[model samples]
Target chain A: MLSETDISAISVTIKLALLSTAILIAIGTPLAWWLSQTKFKFKVVFEAIIALPLILPPTVLGFYLLMTLGSNSPLAGFLEYFGGGSIAFTFSGLVVGSVIYSLPFVVQPLQNSFSAVRIESLEVAATLGASNIDRFFTVAVPLARSGFITAAVLGFAHTVGEFGVVLMIGGNIPGETSVLSIAIYDHVEAMEYSQAHLLAGGLLVASFVMLIFVYLFNRHFSLVRSRDW
Target chain B: MIECQLKINLEGFTLDAKFSVPDQGITVIFGPSGSGKTTLLRAIAGLEKGDSGFLKVGDSIWQTDDNFVPTHKRQIGYVFQDAGLFDHLDVSGNLNYVKKRKTGLKKVFIDSIYTLLDIESLLNRRIGQLSGGEKQRVAIARALLTNPKILLLDEPLSALDLKRKNEILPYLDSLHNQLEIPILYVTHSQDETSRLADHIMLIEDGKIIGNGPINEMLTSFEMPLSHSGDAISIFEARVISRDTDFNLMHLEFNGGQFIVPDNALPIDSLVRIRVAARDVSITKKKQSDTSILNIFPAVVEEIVPEGNAQVIVRLTLNGVVLLACLTRKSSASLKLDKGSSVFVQVKSVAILN
Candidate 1:
């Protein structure tokens, strides 16, 4: 059985994952659409920047993000300018870290799917009297529905399983910034073997379930695309 | 009238076009593949922004040097070669998608287009299940639902086979006759051009080579269409009488009456008659005891030598000119020259529209 702090950490993890996934979808869709459509010479450079977190070491990313969002940093300065406290060691800081950590998981699927949304379809929509925004929502989004599910699930799972960035930024404050991964880590460090097993087992089960959903969804979507129905 | 001037710098070529097409009939932009036919039509539809251009459809200024109108803002219905329809939508869904955008909806317009295209049974069908011709008909119906001021077609029949092309040609002809909307139809097919175009613009290598009324352009010796071995002259005529005994229809034009295989088009309806140059023969007198049906008096107007063996003879009957592509041996045998009076024998005639 998990303790009070463990249950609270699980709730915090769910909250952080949901909020980060929501915010990522809002920002990532337009960015992904632009990335897919642009043919500029420097587009590859922009793509590499977006994908840096994918290949970079998690600790390395955590170290730099710590400096940028720490108490002494400019973002904290901006917070204080509005009579707010430092963003460091807060739930907001964890959310900011989770969003960055899970960004590639959300954006890559979306960008790939947006690219696959045929330009011909959008042109037809425009010729049929749809504006750019209308086409994005009506035609592009519906056509890329599977990609949305994949992106959202990956974003949520990645945020839920994030370790290094959350550790550096959130610092394991139970009921506030502590998440399931960090709580499990704390249990391991304290030699609380039973507690660690419980939390780890739960996360393992949850992650496996999420992956099953994604793979099945991908298979179904590809079948539809190939008209295997 | 649709007046357009466009300048675009594509990767390997630059398209520079200037032409005014009549607002009442089908104006064909005929050219070979990769000749900027589709590019020029897109520029007119305001889908492709050119380096510089001026486009005016009737009174609306769609484009100028700096100012521009987006495609959705322009009242243009463009039908692509592949019949680009939304796969997620059913046929009725596709039609409603455009119909919902219009501020004004007319039941008359909807009823007429549905009946005209013969797509009433296809409203609930999925787009994925439609055959090529059915999809194109749906696309046209969808476009018409918008009540577009101008209609643009980019080789709408290129993806279909001969059977489908024949099936859809009559509907396109009906559209040209019934709707007063200016249609800028692009095609590489000679059959479609002869059948539907009232005005023809011949494009090659991204340039407008020749453009005029269909009759003048087809007859002009300098035009690209005139140089073909299969060059044809079109006669605007009306159905006067039908012969049940011979199963032939009589069409009356300025020069004389010509008979064709009986057609289903009603009496007194205007039809285009295409006389291929090779189907005509010249003699000094109207010969009898032959299988030829159309024989009329004509004067040799001009004779331009073609290839190494043939001469394209321009003959005038009354005031209407017809072209006869005869070999050099035949021309010399008949002693045909400019101002020479002769009787032309007809072998075959095609009823186009």
Candidate 2:
């Protein structure tokens, strides 16, 4: 019963979530690893900054991102110098906003998992002739596999459910910036209750499934950890 | 030879140690808790970066002025107290981790190490399925496959209970002569020290107080080992014969022959025996009517008073060192002095290996 525009919106939402999650994982891994290992005095400041997106209103973050990517900003001017147009109200700008909005969703679990990796294990790997990078990939990454799964699922699910940030920076451009939540909002505003229910029910089911996966993964990981001395 | 002069300065503690140990056998770093023994071992492995340090193992320098080789680059194997095995890997995976890292090591040699540590049957099991002793054995086999020039074990048996410690000690004892590399073992247990150490380095208050072969270090009056209430002497002997009727074995040492309760070991096999200072009594003449079977003529070399009541007498029997603890009153009443001849009556001898 969905219209063609609604179908396009679903596809765009999935694409945006996938791309944002890929970028977040690529960048969040080292950041989380550093957060877990650093002994610096000011590490708490960085931790608070990363966690800001969690407590902050998404509209506030979207408002700032809008200003930063708008035609008047230096970022747009620099991109324009490289033959690119203003990113505001575009799919690229939607991705940038979604990445920042869901950063803590990806990074916090990863940092906790990396912190749980015992220092003794890493030191043993080093003595066994594993270099720093080798140790990170072979020991730290595999040991934190549950964290990676949780982070990816949460980042993708949170990005799919994004409403305010996409609305503020992307402005509901069909097939480009218009996503599932925006499409559902449009249906409710037009008083089309059946279409609203369709999208909203789908999203509710998807989010619940993702949460169930995360909890199951966490349980399995804890059980495995307890088996080790 | 492994030569080291390392200094580490922490918030309230400092570790300054310097010594040279032979590139063979087990050299125990003996100390009480919080005495910087672990810190010294870490520095040698390049795990703890000292403020200023110099370490040379064999001909290659690991750390020195303006140069430092990181832990991965240094050819040393380290075993932690908890075994530190990879929980994500099964037993075989843990053992093969080092094999995958280092190329050109023979598969046969690695298999021999597996057999030596008795972990062949455990290759398929998960690390979590292993008992405390099995985990340590796998950890040791994993380290040996790296073909290191020196092995560093930081209280490898401390995490295990007494039953498990006994289970793993034989494997550790065999590692001394089986491998050519020097092994630096850190332990606070006197039993482990006397059982394993070929050389001993005494640490106290973040400094090296004494360093020598285990025989001299254990019996030296100037050292703290002989002054303790549980002081002991260890000696090597060869099984001469076994009296099956009496359940006894005749053993020959550098000092004299000893008759011990039979252990079923074959004749001509080398064994280690421990004689605690408290188990020895001294008399002016050899007692012929006593039930004690082991008596030898010895000369007093030195006497160290242990508090106000007891004295630890260092004796030399046929050039072999032995320790005897006695009441200071008995020593004075008997007029025991340096170079005084006495008959040492050993009450019992415990076979260590």
Candidate 3:
């Protein structure tokens, strides 16, 4: 049976994953688009920075983020001007860390799909009287539908599985920063094997079902089935 | 008049063009492939920007020295080689996409353009569902709904097969008859040139080689077109009567009458006939025993040498001038030269719709 702390931890995990996924979509879309379309010389540098979290140790990222969010850091001083006070050990701070950890998972699929879109399609839209912003919405976005689905699934799933970054920044404060992975850690530390097993089992089943749904939807809904002209 | 002057560098070739087109007819930009024909059309439509030039389309200066209008803001419709229809939209939806940008019109041309293009049955069909010819028709209709002052077609038929080309050509002709706006059509086919163009602008090596009415350009001695298989005279004639028993139709031109083989057009219908130069022979005197159907007294204007063994004779029968190819041996035996009066024999002529 699941304990009360396990329920709270599950609720906190869902909140973090949902908020980070939303923020990733809002910010990552334009960044991925620029990466796909730009011909700048420093494009390689931007690409390398986004992909750093993919291979870097999660604890290392957590350590750097910890320094950046501490009260004594320059970034914290800038944030204090807006009354944001030391963001370390806060829920919002955990969201910022999860978003960074899942950045490559969301952006790589999007950039590949955006690059696959033909230039002629955009030129045709322009000739039809659509401006730059209008073409981006009407043409590019609709054509990259599959990419969006893959990116959202991977991003949300990756955030929910994150443990090191969550523990480092938003440390377990029961009902505040104690997510499912952290609760399972506590159950193990306190020698409560059954409680840890219940929470871990729930997360495993939930992630599996979500990933299955995405694969099934993509297979059945091939974007506008091609007609035999 | 549309005055265009542009100079630009592309790849390894340089395009330097200058020409004036009439405001209200089909002006075909003709050339072999890779001759910068489509590039010229692109420059005029603002899809291509050159270093320096002026494009004045009936008083509105689209581009000059420092000022320029982008392609979408200019009042022009463009049709690419492939249909380039929006794959996501049905035929009607594609047309509506452009119609929404129209500022002043109260009524949409949905029914008229679709009907004229013979695409009424395809309004609800997705773009991918249509065949090559059907797609082109929808593309043309979509461009028409935009209500542009000039229509730019860049090798619109080059992507289709011969059978499809023949099927779609009549609608293009009907469109030319109905619409008074100037159409800048690009093509390399001689058949399309002869059938659709009112004026022809020939390009080669990225240079303007010739520009004039189709009839004048087809018969000019200075043009290389007159020496090729495309050498033919276009005469406007109406059928006067048909001898059904003999299988011959009598057609009357401004100068004289011709008895051609029985054809499909009804009597009293005006038609265009293309007479090939090779089918004509010259005789010093009118031969009564000959089986030739057309015989007219013509005065030789000039004789141009074609290689070493043959010469092209420029002859005027009444007021229409056409080319006649004769062997050097025949020319020497008949004593033919400029101002020589002779009877010309025409073996056959093709009837062009």
Top DockQ model? 2
Clashing pairs in model 3?
A: none
lDDT of 3 by residue, B88-161 (tens): 56788888778777766546455677678988788899777888889899889888777778888989899999
Give one digit per residue, the lDDT tens place, for model 2 in B1-353: 99999999987889999899999999999999999999998888888897788999998899996789999999988998889999899898897889899999987998889889999899999988899999899998998888999999999999999999999999998898688999999999988998899999999989999999998999998888888989999989999998989999999998899999998999999988899999999999989999999999999999889899999999999999999999999999989999999999999999988
Give Cα distance to truth, residue B344, candidate 2, Å.
Answer: 1.0
Per-residue lDDT over B36-59 for candidate 1, one digit per residue giving the tens place of the 0 to 100 score: 999998888777888778999999
| Candidate 1 lDDT, A133-168, residue by residue in tens | 999999999998888999999999999999988888
| Residue pairs that clash (backbone atoms under 3 angstroms), model 2 | none
How should the candidates be ordered by lDDT, best one leading?
A: 2, 1, 3
TM-score for each predicted model, relative to the true structure:
0.96, 0.98, 0.92
Off by over 4 Å in 3: A184-201, A220-223, B104-108
Candidate maximizing lDDT:
2
Better of 1 and 3 by DockQ: 1
Off by over 4 Å in 2: none
Output the better candidate (1/3) by lDDT: 1
Error of 1 at B56 (Å): 1.3
Q: What is the TM-score of chain B alone in each candidate?
A: 0.96, 0.98, 0.95
Q: Evaluated with TM-score, which candidate comes out highest? A: 2
CA lDDT of each prediction against the hidden true structure: 0.89, 0.93, 0.85
> DockQ of all candidates, in order?
0.57, 0.70, 0.56
